[model samples]
Target: MTRTVLLNNLDHQDLRVITRRSAALGDAVMLAHTFPAEFRDLQAHYPIVFQKSADGTTFHPVALLGLQDGQNLFLDESGWTGHTLPLAIEREPFYIGQDGDEWLVHIDLDSPRLSRTEGEPLFLPHGGSSEHLERMTSVLLALHEGLQATPAFVSALLRHELLESFVLDVEHADGSQGRLAGFYTLNEERLAQLDGPALAALHQAGHLQAIYMVLASLSNFRTLIERQNQRQAARA
Candidate 1:
C-alpha cells in the first residue's frame, strides 16, 4: 500500500530519498513504462514493446528488462548493468498528481527509498527545493508530458494497424525453456507496406524513428538472455 501525499516544504522538510540501486529499493521488474521520447536510449539496452492494459482497451510502451516477472536482468550485486536506466524507473516514489487543474508533486512516504538518516535532501536548510528536488521536478514534468502525448501516439499506431501481439520462446543454457507473452511489437512488414502518404504522415509525426527504435531494440534480447545465463551460472 502507498501512502501518497502532496509534497510540501512544511510537513516533510527533513525528508530524504535514497537513490541507490538495489533489490531492496524495488528494482526487480520485467518492464518499465516508457514513452517514444525515451525509445532511442532504451533501445540501446532494453527491448521496447507495447503492453496492453488489463482491460485490453489501451496500450503503453515499455522497456523489457527480463524474461519473467520479479526478475530484472539488469540488476545484479554490482547494480543496474544497463548503459541507461529508463526514466520511468529512475522516477521512483515520486509521482505527478493533479490538484484541480494544477499539477502537483506527490511523494510516497512509505517507499523504501525514503530515509531520514542519509540520502538526498528534498529541501535545503532555508526551506527551498534542493537541486535534487529540482531534477526530480523536471523528471515529473517530462513524464507527465510524455504520458499525455502517449494517447495520440497509440491512436496513430492503431490507425495504421502497426501493433501485433507476439510471443518469445526462450531456451536457457541448462536446456530449460520459458515463454514471454502478452506483449505487442511493431509489424515491420506492414510498416514497409504502408502507402507513401501514410509513411509521410507518420514521419511528419516523428513516430518513424520511434518505430524503428522498437525494431532495433529486439537485438537486445540476446543481451538479456546472456545476463540471465550468467546469473544462472553464478548460482550453480
Candidate 2:
C-alpha cells in the first residue's frame, strides 16, 4: 500500500530517508527503466536493452542487472557496485506529480525508507529544504525530463525498424543453463544500412550516440554472467 501526498516542509519537516541500498528496501530487481539521456553512464556498467509495454503498444529501455527475476547482480552487503545507478532506481520513494499547471513533489509516506530519527533529513532545523532534499529534487527533475523525451527516442527506433528480438542462452560452471527472451535490441545491420541522409538525421537528433551506447553496453552481459556464476559458486 502507498500513501502518496504532495510534499511540504511543515508536514514532513522531521522526515528522514534511508539512502542505503539493499533488497529489503526493494532494490532486488533484474532491471531498471532507463532513458537515452542516461545511456552513456549506463553503458559502462550495464547491458542496455528494450522491452515492450505489457499492452504491447510501445517500447522502453532498461538497464539489465541480473539474468533472472527478483535478482540484482550489482547489489551486495556493501551496496550497489555499479559505477552509476539508473535514475529510475535512484528516484525511489519520491515522484513528480502534476497539480494543475504546476509540477509538485510527492512522497510515499508508507515507504520503509522513511523515518523520523534516522537517515538523511528532508528539511533543515528552520524548516527549509535540506541539502539532501535539494539533491533529490534535482534527481527527480532530471528523471522527469528524461522520461518526457523517451517517447520520441522510441518512435525514432521504430520508424527505422532498428529493433530486433533476441534470446540469450547461458551456461553456468555448474552445468546449469538459463535462457532469457522477450526483449529487443538494436539491429546493427539495419542501422548500418541506413543511407547518408538517414544517418545525418539520426545524428542531428542526437540518437546516433545513444544507439551506439546500447550496442557497446551489450559487452557487459559477459560481466553479468560472471557475477551470476560467482553467486552460484558461493551458494554451492
Candidate 3:
C-alpha cells in the first residue's frame, strides 16, 4: 500500500498542540492510522464521532489516550463547523479540497520545491497556484471554526477583517449571533492588544489575516471620518 503525505514542505510555525487521542485500558496514545483502531482524539471536549463503529457514545481525547501507539497528537479543530471527529479519517487536509467528515489541514509553502521522487528529501520545492489557493481557503475555513469562544469575538473578527460586515441575526442575553462577511485590516497596535487565545479565535473565524485587506482601505475610512467631522462642525 502507498500512502502519500502531502504538504511535506510546510513550515509548522506557531504550531500549538491543542489536544491528543488515546486508547482503551488507557495505557497508551492511540495511533490508529494503521489497523484495528483508527480514530482522531480531538483535544477539545466537544462531542464527536470518535470511531465509526461506536454508537451513542461521546468521548474526549483523554478516553482514547491510553494506547501509546494507538495514536495521539494535537487536534486543533477549533474553527470547525466540525466539532465532532471520526476514527481513521484521511483528507487532502487543505481548504481547496473537499469538505466533510474528518477535514484535515496543514500549511503550504510559498514555493513548493518538488523532488523527483516522494521518499527522497530535497531542497525546498514548489507546487502550483491551485495548491496555494487551496492552502489559503483551508486555513480560512479552519480559522473561522476557531472563534466560537471568547467574549467580543465578533468585534475582534471585525477588527481583524474576517467579517466584512454583519447584522444582528439574533439577540439574547447570551450575546448576539450574526452573519459575517467581507474582510478587514489589522495593525500591530490592534493585534498586540489581543491575547494568544483571542488571536486564535479570530483566525478560527476565517479572517485569514483579513486585517491586511482592511488596512488597505484606510483611506476610505479617513475620508469618512473627516466628512463626518465637517458635517458635525457645520451643524454646530
Best lDDT among the predictions, by candidate number: 2
Report each candidate's C-alpha RMSD, comma-separated, in the order given. 1.0, 1.0, 21.7
**Residue 72 displacement (Å), model 2:** 0.2
TM-scores of the models, in the order given: 0.97, 0.97, 0.19
Better of 1 and 3 by lDDT: 1
Considering summed lDDT, which 10 consecutive residues are worst modelled in model 2?
Answer: 83-92
- Give candidate 2's whole-model lDDT: 0.93
Task: List the candidate numbers ranked by TM-score, top first.
Answer: 2, 1, 3
TM-score of model 1 relative to the true fold?
0.97
Which lDDT tens digits does candidate 1 get at residues 1-236? 89999999999999999998889999998899999888888898888889998888989999999999999999988888888988889889899998799988999999999998889999999999999999999999888888888888888999999999999998998889989998999888899899999989988998888888899999999998999989888888
Across 150-222, the per-residue lDDT of candidate 2 in tens digits comes to 9989999999999999999999979999998989999999998999999899999989989999999999999
Q: For candidate 3, lDDT tens digit of each residue in 1-236? A: 22223433344321222123222212133322211111122323211111222452221111222112332322212222224343322221222222475444433232122223331232224522334444344444544343222224335544554322222132222343423122122344756677788767656864434433333333333332333344346556
**Considering summed lDDT, which 10 consecutive residues are worst modelled in model 1?**
76-85
lDDT of 2 at 91: 78
